[model samples]
Target: MNYTAMLHTHTLAWFLMLILFIVTVILLKSGKAKGGKIVQMTLRLFYIFVLVTGATLLIWNFYWATGVKAILAVALIFTMEQLSTGIKKDTLQGSRPMVLWTQFIILVIIVIYFGYFVA
Candidate 1:
């Protein structure tokens, strides 16, 4: 039961991911925001905050990560890059919304799996 504030870390990670998902949905729904810079700036700041928390947790608190979980994390990062490229260019030639949600769900499953199994 000794987690060293592990519950808080998991909660933060989940909460961050949820917020990230919602922000992305908003951006997608806005359809490039019709040249509005507000959404763009908001997204930029959100990305920085997300990366800060993600990197900090990765560095400060080691997770007994499984192969599935590790791969999913890498995949999530890759997805983020693809998403950024699409957002910046306002183009999505091949990506689909469903594919992203599927990947996101898988990542969430792995996170929950790790949360319960690793500790």
Candidate 2:
């Protein structure tokens, strides 16, 4: 596919992933493990989509700055995954989830900045 189309797909995938992440967290917090797990699984698929399209975009652009954005994107994904897992397992107590959430937000901001303005 062309760069424009690929970029749109990547954006859409990450948008949906973000929505699903919110839904999953809500469900988990509401004591609906089954529903949360289902949504979490869907979110994981979007994570794959985001990663694949992101890699494609990086391959097309192939710059050091884009590489930095890609790394930040990966880190963002890792934070999301870890946060969700901690929520599911009831391990992220007190300020732990807050810390992860903070990391997620910061990484997302950095990635978006690099993606839209820098790269």
Candidate 3:
């Protein structure tokens, strides 16, 4: 894909992931563990999409900002996996909510940073 198309796909995947994450969080908060499973699966797919497209975008020019964003994106994926696993095993601790929110906030910050400074 062209750079423009790739960038759009990357952004779309990012937004979709964020939306699904929010929905998953809502389901978890509402005690709908079963319902959140589907969304989490979808989120995982988006994570792959984002990673692939992001790597494609960076292949042409290796910039520090893109590198940082890529690292942060991987971290977000790990956080998501951890949170989901904890939720699934019913081992969610009191600190989980804090961790979830903090990760989400970091995601938004990265998004804004990319929008204003990187892309």
When 1 and 2 are scored with lDDT, the better candidate is 2
Per-residue lDDT of 1-118 in model 3, one digit per residue for the tens? 6888988888898888878877887787678888888888888888899888888888865778777777777777777777766766678778876877698678778855875588
Question: What are the lDDT scores of the predictions, listed in order?
Answer: 0.57, 0.94, 0.78
Per-residue lDDT over 1-119 for candidate 2, one digit per residue giving the tens place of the 0 to 100 score: 89999999999999999999999999999999999999999999999999999999999899999999999999999999999999899998788888999999999899989989999
Give the Cα error of residue 30 in candidate 1, in Å: 2.0
> TM-score for each prediction?
0.54, 0.96, 0.83
The order of the candidates by lDDT, greatest first, is 2, 3, 1
- Residue clash pairs of candidate 1: none
Candidate 2 at residue 50, lDDT? 98
Off by over 4 Å in 3: none
Clashing pairs in 2: none
Q: Which candidate is the best by TM-score?
A: 2
Q: Return the top candidate by lDDT.
A: 2
